[model samples]
Target: MNKRKISSLLAVTCITALIVSGCGGGSGKAEDKVVSEKDYEPYSKYESPVEFTIGRNTSHTNNLPKGDSIENNMATRYVESKVNVKAKVAWETDDMDQKLSLSMTTGELPDVMLVSRTIFNQLVDNDLIEDMTEVYEKTASEGVKNIYSSYGDLLLDQVKVDGKIMGLPMTNIGNQHQLLWIRKDWLDKVGGKLPQSVDDVWNLARTFVEKDASGTGKTIGFGMNQDAMNFSPIFAAYNAFPGQWIKKDGKVVYGSVQPEMKEALADLAEHYKEGLIDKQFAVRSDEEKEALVINGQAGMLFNPWWIGYTNYKDSIKQDPKAEWVAVSAPVDENGKFKTIRQDPVGGGIVVVRKGYPHPEAIMKSINLTTDFLYSLTDDAVQYKKEHASEGLTDHSRWNNEPTQIPMQVDYDDVLKRYYDDIMKADKAGSADGIQEDRVVSYEAYQEFKQKGTAVDANTYGEYLSRIEGQREANNPNLEVIPAGFYGTTETMKLKWANLQKMEQEMMLKIIMGQASIDAFDQFVSTWKKTGGDEITQEVEEMSSR
Candidate 1:
């Protein structure tokens, strides 16, 4: 059949099936059977097994149990047993981006693919992905729906292409806030207080460099990666948020080309001139910069709170006294600690092939895994026990298909619940009223009682939660992205990357003392002439609509 005929046939079949066995009785006729809600519950197993193929990122860190492959792991087995869906791995590559691009170019995408926002948008544009509107509504459980709904209209709006939702967005909370990860031990050794302003940071970085806090005489006062010059937390101090659109005088403007950025660049240039920043930072990879922190060569780093997991874990293991703490980005002129907030839409999105037989399978799998991870049922308890030591790596990375609830989603709420309900009880040596989700926090609390700190990853994660919660609760000056900033404009696909490369080059050149600050003005002019103006105009149009 042709595409139109196939679409028409599918539409009729869907309508007929819905009328025969939907929530509402069809004309109250004897031919139609209205089922109870329990019959449609998300957790129930399929009557028979179904199968699909998918692509996956085969990271080396995914340590599966003995004799189990990614396709046949415990999590996959559990999913198959529960949902009756067997997910075969069609392809595996550590570089998901490159692999996905190759698949797209070859017109051979899997039944489902985990993809970043840009790829998802491109797939939708090419008409290679399914419109998941009906399947999601029909299959998503209350918990899964609630999680997405809590993100507000931004989640709904950004995923839509021409009024149709192209993919399911991952859910996370407050993961975008830039934090200053200061080494507390070094701070005490240098007798420097936490930075409260731009000037304070300048002074602290100078002192840290002068004091040779690394103990190897090669201390880097400010740690930075290649992307840092553009996305650095220091920009927050100057109220210049890069990689976003901001409204100024009732018009959309690109953040990187704003005047405030010039000031930030000037300040960074001064830091570089004084040797406070690593002179070779422009060439350092993320792993190398992370090592600078982990090996005690960098006194201060700027990134999100999750850096604790990526960079600090090994350092803490090697040196128990190397304490890292997350602090708010330094205060702006108004005595407010300002930081750029992320678009609430989480990482990668989940997309289905254009003519996939079982579009609802993706929704069902997400609903099942989310409930399995968060719900306190007997099965969920057993699931936790089976994978407690290895964590949820298999479920999240392999079986969940694409996205999982972000690592820091509802982090503060969970932490608050721990303190309010589980802390005192656990301190008194009782486990009553403690939920499964808070079990890890309970363990951390016990460790805190015994060792004056939570040492392991899970336990230390809880410790970081307390600090983040307290900081945000007490003082939050987060500059959130406007509703429409996250959406991609047509020109962005063609020119945004080039624009960002130009911005990074110019910004780095100024900061490295290779180009004068005057270069910023000429670059801004070139930016507008080359496509920034058109992109800004498109953003304004979208925001208005």
Candidate 2:
């Protein structure tokens, strides 16, 4: 974290024991740290508020201007007070593809937008988004630079197309660690220590499902069926990553057509026949599945780090005894685990509108947004500079409030450094040891390093949560995968599209036994014929860069 020797007029000497319980504290008490009724002028309330219309998508929460939401009230008000930039949501949570495509065709855009990698590429192709590279170079702080240094190559690899990195991609603090996410109460009733190895994991699942160890007749051992996310954790150890990696010679060769997929399928099919898997996962919607977890029908589930946050603040509100801990994501029989790194620039919770009046304003907004997140949590920056990476955090990301780090950097060494430092600082009681913007970041680092193992979930709500014996996330010494080249040549695009589609469809079918693994040979033949070969050649060329 960038240390500026905080010289603000608002400085108050923070107490150690006092700040420990930042959450679950009284809101209005003098001891309460919550910013309550502070008088301030908002940026959006300018004489003619510098209108910055933004576009976004929302599923879990409404992104539009809600009367009582923090975005509308606290954060928006905060932005106005601090930056003097009037920000308003123009459009949110509709078909983004259609909106962006129309905007491109019509030459109409908001000031900033949150678009997918594909949309970002299209904007680059059409010369839409202003380049933030120079802006970041000139105005960005050292803390922000640390973020870039960690994921800079990743952004270049995925978001940067045609020699320019267009938009600033949002990032996650950490994700993809295998979390067991098991019911703690059930374990107490079952009367046994946590499992240690793959065999132990299996035995626990079997006993929970068959013996009804938790005394909750409705609950089962492992609560998953067709969920690629939850189920993949257990199988990741045997050199078989969750879905498919499509690798050749040990580098991800897209496992759909690879022979190892047959192995994974056979294992899954056996579990399905044995009744260890969830019967309703196939039909359950996202919300329904979450219900299954809350209702205690399943003792274990799989999920990313964010889900853990909801468990504490949201889900636990309903079931207070429901101590959801993160168990390790399962490892393959050979003690192997893998994660398919997501493109840092692809997925994000926030996006700038395309037609906002000022491009630099968008850059500043992004910088501030990330900085705000990092400051509160302090993950991206801390992990960027930390060394001696070990351990995991006990707290959730929302609670820690660090600047978000993209998941692609989760297992990468570049980030482990930051994580290590943040934890050391937080545990040492020097909260201000780093920048204030990194609260979440430091918390995440500390959660993993200190308390991660203290709270393991049946589902992977947090990375450090332990299952029988394993932590939800992987710490295997693996190399970071290069970001896949987006927006290739026309022939390359067509062929790559066809090849990937064919591979995905065929792989799912083969895994479900709807198609035979033998179909792979046929797939290989068609892959070459359908421009897979050309795309491969193109990818090979791109990789050389």
Candidate 3:
């Protein structure tokens, strides 16, 4: 045989020998046989039910119906019926990190759990989690595999340890960059076009404040909370991506300490001094700041497209005439709307405990759930309608699922499909071929079209977010600067917290004018001396690998 074919044959022989001899080194027990592609089925049900325990991370709001619970919800029941797999909640808490830490100490981990990147590393080092490479390859559905492959190697590479896949990385939605949400009605009243540059944004804000566009005599130019100003759209206009690791001059560098951040901070300090930003933003809670926008005291804020689904939805309800618009504005001098792109793999993963008899169960559950939610099957559509009848909204339903690994092939593509196939093709009123998860959004949009101002808050929010908000976020010209690295390093574990605290304090001080603009240089120097330089080197090494 040729060298390539011989090499592949040898590798297969070695793996078979290891499996038969039980000589491989892994936390989990050795497999009895190799599963061929022909024999393996993604959604095959077990002869008997396979039960696994999970340490669930629950939402603060218990949106489950009166008699339902995290363990007994519609998601759990559906999975059980379809795949013959049942999830028993070992323990659930809103604070999963704290509970997981305790579990590590007590040596009492669940059969499967979704954990953060830091926790995933700990589980690997302790050899408490199974090596899912083989199981995943053999049992993962084509749909799930396709989703991971869509990101190339980026998603799976995060969970690979010593060349073995230790966990399933959750693929995050792309284009999660913040957009400037403005009161378009207020802008019309002030007689200004949509902002195209940072200067334009500043001038518009000034006019909004001066004219009191809200007519409440208490209008603030920009609504901000304690941490919002640091990474706001204004900062992005200056190419300052705080909290992201971005490429600078062929090296991976922390965006927070870059020179561009200094310029952004100086500009923000000027705005704060000019009373353009909320004067009390330094002490305002998120809710308090949001209330400023909802109550018509503020005209502009920087948030993701989903802001319409949040407090801005209330803005429409409170004022039926209010018209909020999403924009990729405040571009740089070159007219490029530069924003930081999210990491491909969300820093969370689903891991199975070592010595679990049915490690493939988790893979099966992910497959079944993904198919049920997105495959547009008749059963899935019917299930969604029944759940909606019970007042179960999309916002909180997924929190009740046992295996909470979010698998999206490409959210931007999904949004594009919604825009093209549904909105452009005028199929918003049609349910044919619509996925179970997005049917409600289509329904809500239809209701908003029919009822206009009389539509409920939920319907208004849905239309605004899916239709209007996504239209802005899906801008093809918006330049997204991808983070160079997203993994945690050893030195980072020891010192990142203190370094982050130092950066946060210094950035806030500079923006609020508590410290001079020159303080940024000193902060950068101290950050490097303390741990930033070492962490950067580690990041460089990791990214290179």
Winning model by lDDT: 3
Q: Which lDDT values do the candidates have, in the order given?
A: 0.66, 0.48, 0.74
For model 2, give the 10-residue run with minimal summed lDDT.
35-44
Best-to-worst order by TM-score is: 3, 1, 2
**Candidate 2: clashing residue pairs, number:** 100
Query: What would the per-residue lDDT of candidate 3 be over residues 214-269, giving only the tens digit for each residue?
Result: 89899899867566543457888888888889988999999888999899999988
- What digit string (tens of lDDT, one per residue) describes model 1 on residues 326-398? 7765777877765544566666777877656566666766666666656535675687577665444443422
User: With candidate 3 superimposed using the best TM-score fit, by how many Å does residue 8's alpha carbon deviate from the native?
Assistant: 37
Each candidate: RMSD to true structure?
7.0, 14.6, 6.5
lDDT of 2 by residue, 216-253 (tens): 58656555544354566555554454334344663424
Off by over 4 Å in 3: 1-39, 58-69, 229-231, 382-412, 425-429, 450-454
Q: What TM-score do all the candidates reach, one by one? A: 0.79, 0.65, 0.86
Q: Best candidate, TM-score-wise?
A: 3
